[model samples]
Target: MKNLKLLKWILILAALGLFAILAARAYLAHRAAPLGPWHTHVPNELTAAELARSDWTGYLEVESAIFTELEMAVTRQLDPADRVPANRYFDGSPLYPGRFAQDWNRSFVLDPDGPPVGAVVLLHGLTDSPYSLRNIARRYREHGYVAVAIRLPGHGTVPGGLTVVDWEDWTAATQLAVREARRRAGPGTPLHLVGYSQGGALAMKYALDAIDDPDLPQAERIVLISPMIGITAFARFAGLLGLPAIFPAFANAAWIGVLPEFNPFKYNSFPVNAARQSSLLSRLLQRRLARAAQDGRLDALPPILTFQSIVDFTVSTRAIVDSLYARLPANGSELVLFDLNRSVKFGPLLHFGGDLDPARLLPAAPRAYRTTLVTNAEADRREVVARVIPAGETTERIDRLGLQYPSTVFSLSHVALPFPSNDPLYGLEPDEAEDFGIRLGALSLRGERGALIVGADMLIRMSSNPFFPYLLDRIEEGIDSSASGRSGIDRDRL
Candidate 1:
């Protein structure tokens, strides 16, 4: 009798809990903002067949049509108050005053002055345009390599496109980019794939796919910046957040974040579907990586160079080591970690736990890959140095660098890896020569909380890398090695 009563109560509580959750979701959905022109203008999901039929030009044509529709809808539906002042969405607003126009959001190819000795495909992060990789692409071009930066579908336009696109669409776009790179480089030339954040996962996936499929072009080297090897598990259930969207009354539930679209190159708003698709992609990549590792096929993967911050809010830094690097063979793979700035005066306020140590994550001795940590030489000093531990060695070697961590910065962020210190938009010391309407990184905002359109946290996060020179030097070293027919880094050069 007692057991039966307990079981009955348990069932009743579970039912009540579920009912309460549904009620809360419905209430929140009803309070959401009304669907705007951007929401109504969702682009058709790109099919694999359609992507197959289209070349880069055809792809751009489809993209232009979508952008045209978005523009028309914005003009007809959006009120002036809904948009930023002097925005392209406004009537009689001058376009491309200083920064790039909306059309610059499309894919771009940069050719070297002479015949390309090598080629590189640069992939930007989710919600980011090809412009994110423009500086890096130019660098590769100057080094006598053809650089192609592809604008992934559902990006570089209105945020609504991300609401309807699937993860497969992104993978398909990656395939197209790789194909174009191979075609331009021709046979026997070194082909490199460089990915940032979400693009990092795509690059890894493509490399794995190439290993399994003989028809696909193999990458000579892979470079990743703040790679999304793993994301939060909450992303798996992100679709549930948009459950209210099923009802027309709660259409705004589809968006996780709806903010003023001030930044021209990146989307300020984010949809629930974007989170779901990224989660799905990361999960798929992990599964594929594990399968390859188990099957011994990952041994065929090319040399990998990854730059990641020790403290990243977006992706798992631990996963990068445990999931990806740990499984790799004794190939010439290198993991560069940007450590926190111990020079900050807030030592007493800061928590110094074992979790802050990078040594804990790496293996004991005779490691399969090289690990380089860029950190402050001392807790009290701003001077920085590179502490390197070569593959298959337990000893450490320190090399003093001319660079020092910025006084204001306590740590490098995931988004800060690829951008330089003097970027007009996101740099610590913004370039005054070029203006993007606003210098986001240079803003030292101070006011009451919630006074600004964007959150204080968003503005506070470091957006540009201070150590980009070191990053560039490392990439140039890799290029030199490829040109010299060497597979591994020359330790003596360091």
Candidate 2:
């Protein structure tokens, strides 16, 4: 009788705990910013199976149709109250991508002036357009390689496009881009895969798939910027948070953020579904990596170069070291890790916690792939240098980069890798020759918090790389080398 009574009380407490959690979630959802037309409109993008059957031209046709649908359904149909310059869905907004000289939001092919020596496929991040990798594409073209940057389905249109996108759709689109890149450069030319953020995950996935599939075009090299190897646990259960959206009163619960879409080429708003899909992709990538390692299929994988921030909030830096790089062979892969600014002037004011210790983030020297840490030459000064530890070697090699960290900036961000200091859009010192309506990276606003429409984090985050010249030089090392051969400084990684 006493045991039965205790069981009944336990059930009662569990019910109460569940109620409190759900109540808090609903309260937060109700308090979120109202959704705009762009959030509500879902684009009719092709599915994974459909994309599989389509070639480059067919994929472009589908993309064209999706944009037409967005124009008619989202932009043209925006209510009068929703017509604000900050909302990208507004037809008259100066931030409209179409108003620019070149709409980098679409999939594009850049051919070298002469017959291409090699080829590359560039993939952008989640909720990002091809604009993210435009600089890299141009660099490849300048080096006589055909560069193809594809706009994955459910991106480059509206934030709502991400609401219905699946990981397979992106996988199929990646395959299509590879096919186009190979076709443009001929079958004999070397092929490289370059991805940023979520694109990094896709690039690694494609290379792994090529190991098993004979029909797919194998990449001679892969380069990843801020790759998503592991992510926060929240992503695993992001779908559950939107469960309340099944009810009419809690429809807004489906979205994690519904901020104004001010950026011309990228979506400021994000949906719950997008996070769920990313989580799925990251999990799948990890599984494949493990399986490849166990079955000795990892040797078939190609060399990879990854650029990562040591203290990234978006993805796990440890995972990049443990999950992906740890599995790599002694192939010519290298990891360029950008460490936090350990300047003495900023030390007392900075709250980086344990991130100040760069040693803890990476394993000891004599690693399988090359490990390069771009950090302050000395903690007391802002001057930077590269400390490289080659594969299977303990000694360190230091190279002066002739660069300095901006005192105001604390560290690099996940989105800051591909862009340069003078990039017109996201640069810290935006170019005088060009403007993308706004120079977001150059803004150094100071005021009381909550006064601005956007969050302080968005304004303060470093959007462009000050050391982009070094990054470009490193990339050119591969481009200028024999298209079929790997780099001499091989510390194989991805």
Candidate 3:
């Protein structure tokens, strides 16, 4: 009897352990789950006296509330079927010439005025707010720039509000922030724009639009981190699934994406209106590209620094590549496409095509611009030749090499490029892989004539996290070589 009781207790304990493990896994997957194309960063607000009086716990509490509020707004917005609209957190009304505006603006900065060397205007991703860019803004402030993270209209509220605001409104908001940055920076001080994900594309769009704006202040440079100027396969899939408009507001299908480890909240995949708005904006961007070519605006585009990762699952490489070739001015733009090996993998599988097992899909072998051109006459009597080029160097190289090669590069699945943090191949530790972000940032900042560094973190995140010793070694070697007069091959490739 005693032995039986002991055995029963053991069984109970084992069951409890299994349950705990399952719970932990669920939480991790939920937190790390990608909200497709969602992305973020911040500063020390305490004065010398306050710093002495307050503990880190107090600061964490305050930050926690801020994050909580931001998440609540985003979450509520994502649940499109919700009965009511989410309240707006930001007031973007033009500051009237009144005492109220002055009073509000005075207390806005979390600190006493610090002498700014310049001004930095930050743009957050779509469906996100200034909250996402807060971390990076704080960094800029630490570096002596007056960092301003603007809340785009219709954002930080209900997702439905977003549908009302068009891409032009987004462009105008960026322009407004740039103007404010310029005005605040005073004479001769440079203005820098940093855009994350969708914000990056908007920043690029603004640069193109303001290329000749006489009233605008001189934009010193631009930084694009994981910019989303093109559409992803999931986005196409969403369209193929017959536009979210056909589904109920609360209907949220499962989506697999790259989730930043820093994000603390779960994401909602519904919000059909948000998807529709995204689709519209994407079409508008295509129209803009066509118009830019027709109007000859591409040649006048401003200098830009762009960063992207090969494994980023949200924004595909095709968008970045297309933007680089079509929008960037010939001589002043820099593009960095970080590579991701297939061996690196993230778990929590999501399969498309309804019940199609993923394992059976078999990871396609890495192909280097294999091309196939087919010519056919349609029933409508239109003759067309379509060329499919898979993602590879030859297609990319051909762009710089000029349009002598095929126009289309085989599309990389959107989520495939920015592989999530949960990817099995990613290794975060204290070793040679230690400081890729700092290295990339330094290299980008230290370039000839001080070129802009677009979301250099995107590349660093995808490359360094997986602990690619060879890449890390090359980075260090490049830094050392550049210090001298010797040119580094890896640096050129990067």
Off by over 4 Å in 2: 1-19, 351-356, 484-494
**lDDT (CA) per prediction:** 0.81, 0.86, 0.42
Best by lDDT: 2
Indicate the worst ten consecutive residues by lDDT in candidate 1.
Answer: 485-494
Q: lDDT by residue for model 3 over 1-494, one digit each (tens)?
A: 99999999999998898667545544544554333212211111333244334433443344345345544554334433322211122221121111121221111122116666667788877666554454456555655567766655445433333433455656666666665565565655556677877787777666655655545554556666667777564454343332222333312222222222221111222343445445566656667766786777666554455555444566655655554544443433445443222211211232233112212221232332122222122222222222233433234122111111111211122222222222222212223332211222112222443243223334333222221222223223322322232221111111
Please tell me which predicted candidate would have the highest TM-score against the true structure: 2
Question: RMSD for each model, in Å, please?
Answer: 3.8, 3.1, 20.7
Task: List, residue by residue over 1-494, the lDDT tens digit for candidate 2.
Answer: 99999999999998898678667767887877667778878888889899889899998888889888888998889989878777777778877777778888999999999999999999999989999898899999999999999999989999888988999999999999998898898866778899999999999999888777878888888889999999999899888777777775677878878777888889888788999999999999999999999998898777788999887888888889889999889987899999888899877765664544557767777788999999999989999999999999999999999999997888889889899999888998889786567778988898897888889888788899998889889988878764546543222221
What's each prediction's TM-score? 0.92, 0.94, 0.46
- Candidates in descending lDDT order: 2, 1, 3
Clash count of each predicted structure? 0, 5, 18
Encode model 1's per-residue lDDT on 198-226: one tens digit a residue.
99999999888887777777788889999
Quote the positional error of residue 236 for candidate 1 in Å.
1.3
The clash number for model 3 is 18
Q: For model 1, what is the C-alpha lDDT against the true structure?
A: 0.81
